[model samples]
Target: MTTGRPPRSPSPSSSPDPFQVKRSSVARLPPSTIATSYPSSGHEASVYAGNRSITPTSTPSLSVSSSTSSDDTVLDESDDHDLHTALTSEQISSTIRNEFGYCANQNYRCVSQHNPEKPVAEDEIEEPPYYILFTTYLSYLLVIVFGHLRDLIGKRFAKSSFTHLMPYDGYAPLNSDFDSFYTRRLKQRIDDCFSQPIASVAGRTILVYDRYSEDFNRTQIYTGTTTRALNVASYNYLGFAQSHGGCADAVEESIKRYGVSTCGTRLEGGTCDLHRIAEALVARFVGTEDALISSMGFATNSTVIPALVSKGCLIISDEHNHASIRTGARQSGAHVRMFKHNDMRSLEVLLREVISQGQPKTHRSWRKILVIVEGLYSMEGTMVNLPKIIELKRKYKFYLFVDEAHSIGALGPHGRGVTDYFNISPSSIDVLMGTFTKSFGAAGGYIAGAKPLIDSLRMRGYCGPYAEGGAPCVLTQIIASMASIMGVSSDLVLPTSTSTPISESSVNEVLMPSVADERPLPSKVPASALPAWLSLPPLLSDGSEAYERIRRLAFNSRYLHAGLKKLGFIIYGHPFSPIVPLLIFNPGKMPMFARMMRKLKPTPVAVVVVAYPATPLVTSRVRFCLSASHTKEDIDVVLRACDELGDLMDLKHGRGERWPIEEIVTRSVELVHSI
Candidate 1:
């Protein structure tokens, strides 16, 4: 954390040979590469991949393959001819443009590292036009009034419908009118906008099943039609949600070998060799002493937090934290307090008050205190002020817990999570929790910390004894994706005996690289710790593919964030954040915005629009989750769509310098770099 801004790298314009797309014939990456030995500190063995060193900063040149398939016709049919030509035949055949859009222009990629010399930008929430506010409130007022009226009439006149809301037999109704009001009235109106069914991989594009509600959304009937739409709705951050890729291939092998499940809880013989491998990799990835895996992301917090603190302990949490954090705090029986989201001053003030006041009515020393905050706020798109929080933690002496569910693999230069993004040591935070669902395209979560903390949770936390263990397929996906991010070392030896259980001590025995500034985590995965059967493609094994994914996601996130701001829309969150929330003030516009985007001609785009309950009523918004699988042209389509719809819907109300959609699309690379 140095003062002032770090000088910017030389501008793209300054290069004599600025990024140019050149037509070239390159050798396709062989299915299996020669294993290159990596210098290791321990016993070494032959690696699966070859010794060829690939440039991590630039996109590798891939050419036509010897074989082609009918599925490869999508490349020829794609509108992005330049990209189609640039991709190798193997890539073209394996990747459907609709599933994973390809982009070869290196200028559109940037590293997501923070410059200590530069001050973090203020993430102030912008107010919309006064008229927008008035209309939004009025809209909610009318809806509430009408909703009550409908309930009044329906309860008396529609006795059949009221049967469920009224007492039936000895048992009271499962849901009373008062309890079911919101879901029955307001949510039903926009039901079609949410829970959209899809038929394909939720990658760059999704096959949304077409359906309509004939009975006012009480029920939906399928039309047996599917529409392909550009996807900005899913949590596929680094674009690993693919059917064909190195990760997918590894997963298939895992499934064939281990079937689907471990069949029981960890303590009940559910744990497998894969779990040990994944936990070790996760610990290494996040630069922690050790890690514990959970079957569900939400459960990871809800179950583990209770084990950490209880009764007299105080949990200071961000007001905008996810539901799981709140659940965990409540279940922990800890005295919960809140600070305004990402407001360091408010947090410090609260910290002082709580410290002075002590536990409620006791006026005595508290047992322990934990400050819980999300690395990235899912709903608001704001990031926790980690650097400031770290500084405060030193003074306040409160244990810190960062929920990086949405930040890991999506933020930071090496996709190592928030600690990496802020250039802070992972050891600074007491606990680091993250999920594989968002960035890894897998289904579980992990809790990482000192070996003792994880070991304690394994015994005290409910998940380890009651919940089912991580599935073999899911663990394989995590291992493959994580290893790709942390390239596998060729000189590492594979464990000889499958019967030999891997313990924390054995994993910790792997050599820890010398700690260096800006290099907090190990650069490569200790292939010796991985299962011998798992094999990764050369690009994946070399780390170039994952590096590209990280940089591409960074570029997409910045371009979208900046593009919307320049379009005169009041967007929330850090510029580097992938979750971009565009305020649509009026609740009526939520469904309208979602529908308009989905119905865009030529190529429909799917977006997630959230309203009351998710956010403040007036801040009903459409959240765009950018992914690495998306091409520049895909983002151009989104920007253009937003520009057109924002005008028609009267949603652009920010007081900022504006740019036309054309400029935003044409100068996207420059715009991304500027941010």
Candidate 2:
């Protein structure tokens, strides 16, 4: 049989016959064989037999090799199966030009166009210089190798010594000597134990773990093998923080439609239909003519307060009003005077003093006097005596600004905040500010009040001109939460008894009653005492889920408070308030107790430890916020753990023992003055 071999050319020379075939004396190879040998320079072209194809794998190297004579050219067989495949002459030429830097126009010639002895001009070069190419590859190599090494080391440290690196005992030293002492110590030693994973939602419970069980599951059952503990450290007062309900659904839908941000200030292009709707709903919910929403809850006060009261005004603020209010008061340049927290008598004293003193040095009557108080004090877990404050405001002719950040969705039968809870008129509040972050399952805040006040804010407030507006998704969440509170079918109507317009004469008459009088001014008016006209039923029926959630929250608060008190723990706040504070007087023991509580058996309870700066240094405490989502069983588990841990750490108070409230307040004042 005749093999398929090409016929030999007539002459060896004669323009060096391009199609000449040469066969070796060795065994004939298959047509699929590909030449393996090539020149050292990148210009070498690949050779294939028959119709086998070659494809370019990467950008061709720019360096060229010296040319070879036709007689000296040789090909070697390659074992690479990919090179054995058939290819057309066009593909071969393209591959040679693309991957081997061969000149296809010169019939796959591997010759350098530029002289090696002379430097090529930048205009003549197609590729980067050799030094530049070398540095680029070096950088990529270093990044890849070092990145992998870093990941490996990080993972090892995180799983091992990282968990125990900074103990709570070391934290006190760091806090005390941050600038002078701790700064020079080992950097890792200064890290706080609770620095990682700031408890955002905490779900139903928080997860706590130590070095031994760092990789434990969040829902791990208590077999004492793992350190994972349940969480109760967050401020999800109504269990709305991490809820996956209508509000969440609305937020998702709004995100799809409006994106993540407005990218503009409220007065520019930031305001949306959802924002307007949310503002209207908030105004109606708070029984106000209008409302203004701010992108940040804190900024609502920091910005609005400055706009409302200026140099000519006087601000009579509660001692324990939120830091946001204090910041706003300072920024306002108003004459500020603080009364003892929740102390109505002290407030009256301040009001009388401020009224008598008038403007400082000027000795002139103040243009305006605004009284700022919170519906619920965050650290103290106490509710403001709104009725008494309103009585005082009416008597003293001062505007009342109530920050209901923690109380809006946490208190009252319908979560209408302190005004509704105390059976006081919402109109009595001059500027009712509340945040959506706590109970409404979203961010941003609102300042709801008379139409003129809101209108004034819209025109003159700094936030309107300078700050970005709330995200559309946030507005959707607010609307969804308000809808849930008011129900779909019913309008939110304030109870007639509380809605009565407050008059100076009426408040005087109410406060005139004495302890010995047959009818003393009611400390808190019960729903039963309301006249028939003022005793309208809630929009949601008693059987409704919304009503039940509020009821369950109230029940959980009482249950947890009583349980902790029974365990000999000194508790703070009204029994009805959802926030419960357990006094841990020893600063050193506060973090220790929190860490130990997280290591409890059966289930761990996650509680937030509040220390100096947030609270009095001598009165550091652990705060537990109850939620409607928590079951009776969940409450019981936490209580049981607290009882056991309290005893173990000797943190339990003596029976009927309490922190002297007056003494603590006095010391706190003194400390503040000294500072």
Candidate 3:
């Protein structure tokens, strides 16, 4: 060999280069959009979608034809998960084996670009990732096993339910013809510990641990022999809702001000000054000229969707739209349509069809073709392509309404939200909606957009608490204080005008355009506290560390993700998200696993189990959360538990064999084909 020569390149040895990626698919995608016609630099795409090759268009391209009535047959054994669409092809498009599961760039070179000759074994390429393989394979396992799994789970619960039918050893059924024993008897029966142990609080050990001390060095109020164990079985998508405490203070203040109730529907007695202030904060947060507040994120979506739509409107919704949107669309009274989730091309096809069909429902109702979307889909924790959606909106002349209930505070820089996350103008989104419970940690919601839209709602359909007596005094203080606390200028209230249209263009230049600044608007006065919508209490954000940590949550989430992934377990959420779901497929194992996690450490954690009613039966998962209070060590403990449980499940399921890549790969591919 030449002295110091770039060590003579290894021959094409017997060991196949893991770095050599082979795209076995019959087709290839262009490096850029198909419409752009930019040639790729020989980088193969493991990323697959049925011809997502082109950029998004205004017309709907995906034909919403049924695959087959037989394939769509409801499994008789499958219980009512309610979320029947969880298993849709639209939701489970990518696999870990498929490209995005491991690396951020699905098209990055596997080996050192400089040394093409020295490649690692193809099997050694950790690029595709193990989790993706696991999930893809698991999904396949679900397809083959969901019905059986559903029956097994149902049978377990069913057998457990019939404790009443069982013959009690002592005093069981009371056939004594005395009706007097009803109330007393009922109380005794209700108190009877007849039920089977649903799950063990301690998987293998009854641990005496303190979660607060272990995780945060703070007080964990729930622990020990007499711990208040609440079944948070419905807690879905990890615990992003409870991770932040700023929401608790905001909720308290809101109650003090708004008086714990909208009192009625927003259109009835519910709309209050409290409601308006809530909407205004949201409007500022989302960068819109107008906004509305509602009881829930679901309502924000359902209400706005139909109000903006009419009989002739055509909607090109992501096939995987959250249930609320689906209900809204179905009830919209407009011509409803759908596209593949995140499929720009499918949306184009639908949009084109609607446009070609042409002529709005008698233009008397301002051509109302509205594009609706959810910020962070609750289950998958996936994101919509906002940039593409905006483009389609502009091109198709459709109004865009984005529900940011899940996107606020958890995504994007400074949590300006999904619009901000995409680096797109918040102005492009015709409507923005969010819930207070997630990022804000409050218990309400708001919608934002142009003043005319709200004005129209107010005149024809508007009704709020103002219709009753007045907004509660406490809500005003909370709004003022919250606005102050959130660092919002006091004059959040826009001038009320029922007679004339609010001039937005003139308003933006003269008044504070975005709600982000600390300076007061021309009309706004300094309030005692910031608005509760900001959710930061006076005592809380005042601390330098509190503010710093609040700002760095996303970084913490990323760190936690890296840690957990290294331990070999699944974590759910979009890229760069604080939310994580430590997924476990077995519904039965959930409660048991939670107890295991709690007992495994010095402090037992009750990781919530998201089951049937929250997610589909096929989507049951254990949601593990990360808190700002968590230190690096805390995350590692959680990660270890996740790994242990995952390993346990894989080992116990079949011949104690590990979940092999070859098996997962072939299974996942087969599942994809069958779908």
Candidate 4:
């Protein structure tokens, strides 16, 4: 936990010598007078000016030294009172120096004047520089003046005068009116205050933004004009999104052998050795009999859902499920029923109601029922209660489908998926779907389950012949990444399951362990103790190093979460997860908060600001994605910047009360005009 730096010591040049005191400047009082005026209480001391008590801000120290004789010294109350009253400020400061070894300041002035060259203590410093004060005052004045002007303008103009100039109201612009309304109003508003969206790639310690300038020719693509910035937006969880190492080397070799594109679907001549290897690895990793790979992560769910479920079936889904799943469910022509997000009780209630009521219009039992959920909710960063869901599945006779897009290779002891995290057999899940774009550092997705189900999809699925298969290079990257994560080389043989296809009647028997008995497995192993074949030389090096990366990532996430919470930020999700959401409850301040974060000094932390449609109107937030590549120092810097910005903008929760959008927009527009 130590930062590897030594503790700072006080400089000798700043401290004054107490023993070298000037006795001539101090006033002496009569001992008889002091004896009559001092109190009898040894510990309790008080000073009085006439009838009123004049208490010192701090307790004064008393030193008694008798000049009569060294042997005749009196350390009594009377001597203590005489010493306290007779000593000047400088003498008292000298006494303090002698005791505490530091100069003490009182009443906005230094008591000890022994060292004139030394700088004044921070407590004695003046206000901020003149320029800061002037600008602050000017800004306040402008707001007041411009606010009145906006009010006047509104009163002078009728409703129709500015109707066309105003932007759309509510969460999003109406689709029919968007072109006319947004082009003339919203576009201008954004252009005035926001920069154009630019693209970038991950580099060492920063994101490299590609830009065009006058120095480069118009047709030249390699102008190389770039700006480096701190990356906080990307989801490169395992730190595998690099130009070098095992993943890159594999990609290079695959490209040289097979060229760039597959040019056909998996059913045609597009099935290469890399594709077969990747699919086998995925099937083994998830503990399933088979898996089907696709070129696109989104299309995997969109195309496969319809192939499995259709019109006579019922699909019960979580309300906050991803768009791809929702789209696929709609296309399947099944009766879709949505339950509240992560609310197990709500889901149970719906199941009970549906079972009692039967199919719509016809009081007959439903043909088939399927329950779908995600391993991790992307927006809220919360995990689904898999054990509870499995229990519900058994009781209700419903098939379960878990999308491990966020949880695979990021959760569990072996990075297998959520099933491993809960110590449940993968056969318990009817269908396990996941994307390689996140943890695997590749572009593709897979649907793993029993061999029969996969074979059905390969033959009847729409994506088999119409959609292009994954590129040879991308397949190689996926295979290498999976092997490295499992602590094995490409040639190493792994343990595989020989279980038959999972059927509705055999669900309970196949998943032998009861839901009540299931528990989580250890999520990490010591990096140094891993097998030699798993070591990827320069990149992963050893198992200990790999373990350290995951550990450091979790630690950094918790550190940042605690810091943001301390600053009054309403954070979402559990402390263990790396995805942190800094909630901005006031919808109007979401854009302002994002702009402030980008303007932070030293280096800008790139955060994705999610708003309405993605989240509820008032629950918008800035999402921070932590990675193994980030250091503790990077986390600390971000925390400090966010704290300062939150306070300055009064955006922190429970600090400033929420204001109406009209008031906020009015002020913003006024400020913009004034600027």
Best by lDDT: 1
Q: 111-219, model 3: which lDDT tens digit per residue?
A: 1011224321111112224554466457546534654454356446875533343335675643321332322222122221112122222211111223333322222
For candidate 3, give the lDDT of residue 354. Answer: 64
Off by over 4 Å in 2: 1-193, 198-201, 207-228, 263-270, 490-543, 657-675
Which model scores highest in TM-score?
1
Order of candidates by lDDT, top first?
Answer: 1, 2, 4, 3
Question: How many residue pairs clash in all the candidates, one count each?
Answer: 9, 12, 39, 3
Q: What does candidate 4's lDDT look like per residue over 57-129, in tens digits?
A: 3622111100011111111112112343655433332222211111011211101011224421111111333
How does residue 321 of candidate 3 score in lDDT? 77
Q: By TM-score, is 2 or 3 better?
A: 2
lDDT of 1 by residue, 1-675 (tens): 111122234367532111111223222211212123333322111121123222233646311110122232222323223443555443444444555665667798989888899877668878877888888899889988998898789878987877888777887887877778889888997899999998777887887889988878999999987787889999999888876666776787776666887742132244576786688688878887668999899999999999887777789999998998899999999899998888899999998888887778866656677899999989888888899999998888888999999999999999988888889998788889999999999998999876656766787788888898888889889998889889987654323334344332344444322122224477887666676677776777878888888998999999999999999999999888899999998888889999989899877889999888888868899999999878788888899999999999998888879999998888887888887
Q: Candidate 4, which segments miss by more than 4 Å at Cα?
A: 1-175, 178-200, 208-225, 263-269, 489-545, 654-675
Judging by lDDT, tell me the better candidate of 1 and 4: 1
Error of 3 at 267 (Å): 16
Candidates in order, TM-scores: namely 0.85, 0.60, 0.54, 0.62
